[model samples]
Target: NAGVTQTPKFRVLKTGQSMTLLCAQDMNHEYMYWYRQDPGMGLRLIHYSVGEGTTAKGEVPDGYNVSRLKKQNFLLGLESAAPSQTSVYFCASSYYLLDTQLRKLFFGSGTQLSVL
Candidate 1:
C-alpha cells in the first residue's frame, strides 16, 4: 500500500505561474500536512488538515492554500507562484496515538518546485 504519494516530482515555473501539488495516502490517517524545505533550513509546515473537509494554515501559509476533499487526498495550491516560493515540498500524514500521546508522520517523496 502507498503510505503517501506526491505528484509532479519536479516542476519549473515562471515568476507568476501557478500550480497545485497533490498528495495521496492509503494509510487512512487522521491528520495531513504540507511542508517546504529550503536550502539551509529544516522542513517548515505550510498547511495541514485534521480530517477530511477541515483545513488550517500552518507556519508558512502565505501565498499558499490547501484542501482535504477526500480522506486519502490532500492538495496544496500556489495561486501566483514566486521565486521565493521555490522549494522542495513534502506532504505528510499521521494519526495521534492516545496511549502513546505521540504521532509519527509518514512523508511523501516530495515535489521540487522552481519559480523563476
Candidate 2:
C-alpha cells in the first residue's frame, strides 16, 4: 500500500507562475501537513489539517495554501510563485492512537520546486 505519495516529484516555474502540489495517503490518517525545507534550515511547517474539511495555517503559510477536501487527499497551492519560494516541499500524515503516546509521521518522498 502506498502510505503517502506526492506528485510532480520535481518542478520548475517562472517567478510569477503558479502550481499545485498533490499529496495522497492510503492510510486513514486524521492529521495531514505540508512542510518546506530550505538549504540551511530544517523543515518548516507551511500548513496543516486535523481532519477532513478542516485546515489551519502553520509557521510559514505566507506564500502557500492548503485544502483537505477529501479524507485521503490534501492539496497545496502556490498562488504567485516567487524565486524565494524555491525549496523542497514535503507532505506528511499521522494518526494519534489512543494507546500510543507518541505519533509517528509518514512522509512522502518530496517535491523539489524551483522558481526562477
**Worst window of 10 by summed lDDT in candidate 1:** 95-104
lDDT of prediction 2? 0.95
- What is the lDDT of every predicted structure here? 0.96, 0.95
Tens digits of lDDT, candidate 2, 3-115: 99999899999988999999999999999999999978999999999999999999999989899999999999999999999999999999998887568899999999999
| Top candidate when judged by TM-score against the true structure | 1
lDDT of 1: 0.96
Q: For candidate 1, list the clashing residue pairs, or say none.
A: none
Query: What would the TM-scores of all predictions be?
Result: 0.97, 0.96
User: Model 1: per-residue lDDT, tens digit, 14-114?
Assistant: 98888999999999999999999998899999999999999999999999989999999999999999999989999999998999989999999999999
Supply candidate 1's per-residue lDDT for 18. Answer: 89
